[model samples]
Target: MSAVLQLLVLVVLAPYLVGLMRQVRALMEGRAGAGIGQPWRDLRKLFRKEPISPDGSSWVFVAAPAVLAATTLVIAAVAPFAATVSPLDGVADLFAVVALLLLGTVALALAGLDTGTAFGGMGASREITVAALAEPTILLAGFALSARVGSTNLAAIVERGNHSPGDLLSPATLLAAVALAVVVIAEAGRLPVDNPSTHLELTMIHEAMVLEYSGRDLALVEFASALRLTVLLGLWVNLFVPWGIATSEAPLALLGGAAVFVVKVAVVGAVLAAGEVFMAKLRLFRVPELLAGSFLFGVLAVSSSFFLA
Candidate 1:
């Protein structure tokens, strides 16, 4: 029941979160911006249009959006967003969650290559490159966090954090948080990594891959992208700031947890958006260096957990 509520909240609130981030960026830039409802309106418009496929595309192209969306939904359902005692808690292993995320990324990369367009191929190459660098940092950070608890289960990590607040301030935890923050930015294709708003062929990483998608396919892709961001941010919050999460199964506790979850995620998203306003995307060749630095932090985190124990 808690898992279902988390999934519903993610599906319904993800778009508005995107809109909120965009609005924050706009406001920072002194623009009035479109209202927060704009993303929902854009999604509705996209769903009403007829989907079109590229002439040479195969089943991979037709299935990538659904595959991507399905993987994200799975993560949202099993992850400890609102409550620590979810029905699917047994399956919420950190490695499994990371693998599911990579599966969606690989599916979309394959779809990009399947399109046979030069831009698609280029984007696929870049996306895979970024994923290769970003995903490992996520694993290392998760392992660092899980080391103290002796279990890779995400619920165990969060529940432990809730019960032991001092762990959140440890050297290992702080280092892992910094590493994962960079991973989230890279994985979500945000600025200083890949500009989500860019359309230029030379600069596009994620956008180039989906250039051929239209109508319902486009809507699914966009929504999945938004949900992925929300899931990543939510996971980060629950892992590092598990104070407000419900540890029990009571209805009131679950409701309060859900409300707190939204507020935390929104605050992080707004901060990220505001930060991006003052930053510029890194040169393509330099992105690997940034990710490599994050990976180093993950390594340091692991070392800190062992030595500082």
Candidate 2:
């Protein structure tokens, strides 16, 4: 039941979260931007239109949106949302979650390359390059957390954090969180990595990959992007900082946990949006260095765990 509710919350709230982040960015810039419901309106508009496929593209091009949305939805469904022991937690370990996320990335990359456009190929190449560099950091960070709990299970990690909040303040834990904050910025198409709203071909990464998608396909891709961000952010918060998360199945606990989850994510989104306003997007060649630095942080996190323990 908790898992079911989690899934519902994921689908229903992802667009609004995107809107909220955009609104935050706008307010920070002293502009009266669109409402927090703007993304929902955009989604509705996209769904009402038709999707057009590029000529010479294969099934991968046609099905990429579905692939992206399905995999992300699965990740969100299995994530330990409000409760540590979600209905799907039995099958969701950290490795499984990471692999699923990579799967979505790979599918989109394949689709981007499948289109055979200069922009698509460029986006795919750049996206894959970042993913390759960022993969080690993500795995090492997960391992850092899992090692302390003696299990790679996300629920175990969360349960451990909830029971021992001191762990959240440890050197290893903070380093992993730092590593993941970098990872999410890259994975979720945020600035200083890739701008989520860029249209210039040279500066576009995630947006370029979806350049050929239109209408319903576009909507699915957008939703998948938003859901991926939400899920990744949720995991980051719940794993490294599990204070307000529900560790029990009690009703009051679940409700409180849900409220806390929203508050945490909103605060995170605000900080990220505000930071993007001040941070310039890194040069394409410099991206490798940033990801390398993040990977180094992950290594230090692992080393710290071993030495500190």
Candidate 3:
């Protein structure tokens, strides 16, 4: 029941989260932004339009959006968001969760290549490169968190943190938080890594792959992207700041937990958007350096868990 609530919450709140971020950025830039309902309106319009496919595209192109959306849904369902306990806890291993994320990424990359467009190929190559670097840091950071719990299950880690508040302030936890935060920014294609709002061919990492998608296809892709950002932020919140999460399965507790989860994700998303306003995307070649630095933090986090703990 908690898991179902989480899935529904993410689906409904993801677009609003994106809108909140955009509103924050626009406010920071001294402009009156579109209201927070704009993303929902856009998705509604897209769904009503006819979808078009590129002439040479195959099944891969037709399926990638669904595959990506499916993976995001799975993760959102199993992950400990509003509640620490979930019916699918057994499958919510950190490694499995990360693998599911990569599966979606790979599916989209394959679709990009399937398009046979130069921009598609270029974007796929860049996306894969970023994923290769980002995914490992996510694993290492997860490992750092799991060391104290002795289980790779994400629920176990969050449950342990909720029970041991001091653990959140430990050297290992702090380091892993920073590392995972960087990976989240990179994985979400935010500023200083890749610009989510840009279409400049030289800087397009995610947008290029879906250049041929229109109508319903584009809606699914966009929704999946927004959901990815929300899920990642929600996971970070529950992992590091598990205070408001329900440890029990009571109805009232679940409701409060869901409300708190929404607030925390919205705050984090707004902060990220505001930060992006003052930053510029890194040069393509320089992206590896930033990722490498995060990787180093992951390594240090692992070491800290063993030594500092």
Candidate 4:
């Protein structure tokens, strides 16, 4: 029951989260911008249209969106979103979750190349480059956080955290939080790494790769992209701040937990929106440097745990 609720929230609320971010950005910039329902409308419009594939594109192009969205849904289910325990915890480990996300990334990258367009190839190259740099930071950062509970399984980490929340304020925790925050920006294709609203092929990382997709395919891809951001942010929040998460499967606790989870994610959404307002997108060549700095933070986080904690 908790698993079902978790999955539903991830799927149904993911687009709304994206819309909220846009609205937040819009208000910060002093423009009304698109309303909070814009993403939902966009998805509905895309699904109602016809899907077209690029010439010579293989089945991978057609299948990448499903794979991406499915993997994201899987991650959300396995993680303890609104509950301290997960219905799918048996298959959910920190390492396994990260690997599943990487699988989706690889599939999309291959699909980008399969399109045989220069923009597709360019996007794939840039996305893969960032993925390679970001992957290490993810592993190291997760390790830093997991080290406190002495486990790499996310459920275990969250469960242990319920018993012991003191470590969340330690130097190691702060370092890991900073590292993961940087990763979230890069992984989710946010500003300073990549812009979701941009059409400039030369500067686009994620949008460029999916430029050839249309209709349902594009809807799935865009929905998956939004889901990706939502899941990653939720996971980070649950990891760093496990407050209000129900440790039981009781109905009331689930309700309370769900409400708290939404509030927490909304707060995070606003912070991310405000953050992008202050920073401009970095040059493509300088992206690696930003990722490298994140890697350093992750390493320091791990080392601090060993030496200081």
Candidate 5:
């Protein structure tokens, strides 16, 4: 398959995965749930509705989701989906990927603050505070894997892992993966960090920031958030466990690779949803402590990588 086609698949399927996870969560909670296609319907409904922005808000509120979605789509295009292949592989550096991802997060947080609502300001402040610490953990943990593999490019790391899946069990790899998993939960606004389902003023972090967005603006932001979650989960699966990802251009191999990719992502999403189901939301103040533990784990993982290498 062509890289362009693969990118299109990612762009289209990312939201479906988020919706599926929500469906799974709803089932687990014993509620009749919206199907996986519900998000698409929600997006359509949102786009047809009239937008209502805050009077205090600037263009930032309108522009944030476009910037975020564009950046995230580009980042997804560059990340290795099937072995060493990437749509933007020629320029794929893991550090640059991490930076691009963070850029979107920072932009959205700034947009939240630009609204000048109390919830917006509070959300932005807390978001950035958590982000300031989480970003380094992401870089360092991924860097540890890159250091061991001899390339900071995600494609190269996956190439190496595909040839040696056992390496995923290494102390450094395990530590990095575990730390990255925790960071993913925090980064994606899952439970034990932030809750997406909550409307309570005091406990919400991500939802609080977008209280001012409505219609298409809100839809875009929510869709972008779900896409970001899918992207991060894809990165985790691609980097740590890449056994069946395509390394050859053969059609059969590519088909197999794509199947493996879907299975891996589905299992990861299910585990994440289950974790959310079993856990309660953390307090606002305790969020910092939870993220701090992830940071410490990431630091240890990085240190172990250098020491072992």
Candidate 6:
């Protein structure tokens, strides 16, 4: 109905999307996973539990969750759920969205370092390194889409992509999509990049950073991670294949738009789940090489956009 309400829907729906992904992954592996609302239950249980801070932890430890949640909620507010309209539309741009996402990332990384644990420091170092390398590709790929539309606003990108199914098939758009997809895997801690479910210290990039946080704080961080995944996937949908995104405010139009959006997200989630199940995690040292290839692809995409245009 309203932008505020739609924003709330995105927040609430993000967790379910995570659950659905888990369920799909489970089904693919022939294991029955927890129910689709498990994330909500996990959050509720965590909130009721008492937090346990490490002996050396300080205010930075306590503030990390608040900052992470606030940053994610702000990013969600600016992200268009149905179409071009967002709660923070006037202040939102594709590049600004990228920055906000990175801000949350930096805050978490700093908090990880503040804990002074070996794993925390190591994770933070790896996370920032991956981030530093991934961010340029993210911006350049987004710019490729924006370059075609002549605006950096995310909503505009979606609006234009929706009208042109062939938009993504363009050499620039395809190359950018491939690059952004790699960045998405890295940014979201998915398999073949950084495995979110890993317990091994040497392999973990995200979990190691949060190993010191417990109870509510850990829950917030995990939830934010899930939200980050949703944001990245939504961006992929909007910028690459925005077929069902609606520009109309009418009841039926919005309803149809919502239906299409759900189906599109589900399809993407299932595809990702399957990919994860079939793919092995990459060696930690080799991660940069993969990301570097993505950056090169993105560069080619932008070049194609300019020369081919």
| lDDT (0 to 1) per candidate | 0.95, 0.88, 0.94, 0.90, 0.82, 0.83
Q: lDDT by residue for model 6 over 1-309, one digit each (tens)?
A: 635555666677778888998998899989999978999999888888778888888898888877877877777767665656544676668778878878888998988999989999999999998999899999989888888889888887888887777877899999999999999989998989887767897799989889988888888887888777887887787778787776867767666766676677778977998889999989988999999999999999989989997
Stronger candidate by lDDT (2 vs 3): 3
CA deviation > 4 Å runs, candidate 2: none
lDDT of 4 by residue, 94-185 (tens): 88888988999998999999999999999999999999999899999989987877888887877776677888888988899999899988
Per-model TM-score on C-alpha atoms: 0.99, 0.98, 0.99, 0.98, 0.95, 0.95
Clashes of each: 0, 0, 0, 0, 0, 0
Question: How would the candidate models be sorted by lDDT, starting from the highest?
Answer: 1, 3, 4, 2, 6, 5
Model 6 weakest lDDT span, ten residues long:
1-10
Candidate topping lDDT: 1
Question: Which regions of candidate 6 are displaced past 4 Å?
Answer: none
Q: Report model 4's TM-score to 2 decimal places.
A: 0.98
For candidate 1, lDDT tens digit of each residue in 161-188?
9999999999999999999999999999
User: Tens-digit lDDT track for model 5 on 3-112?
Assistant: 55446656677778888888889999998898988988889899898889888778888898888888888876677775466446767787788788788888889888
TM-score of 3: 0.99
**Candidate 4: regions farther than 4 A off:** none
Q: Residue 94 error for model 6, in Å?
A: 1.9
**Candidate 3, 141: how far from true, in Å?**
0.1
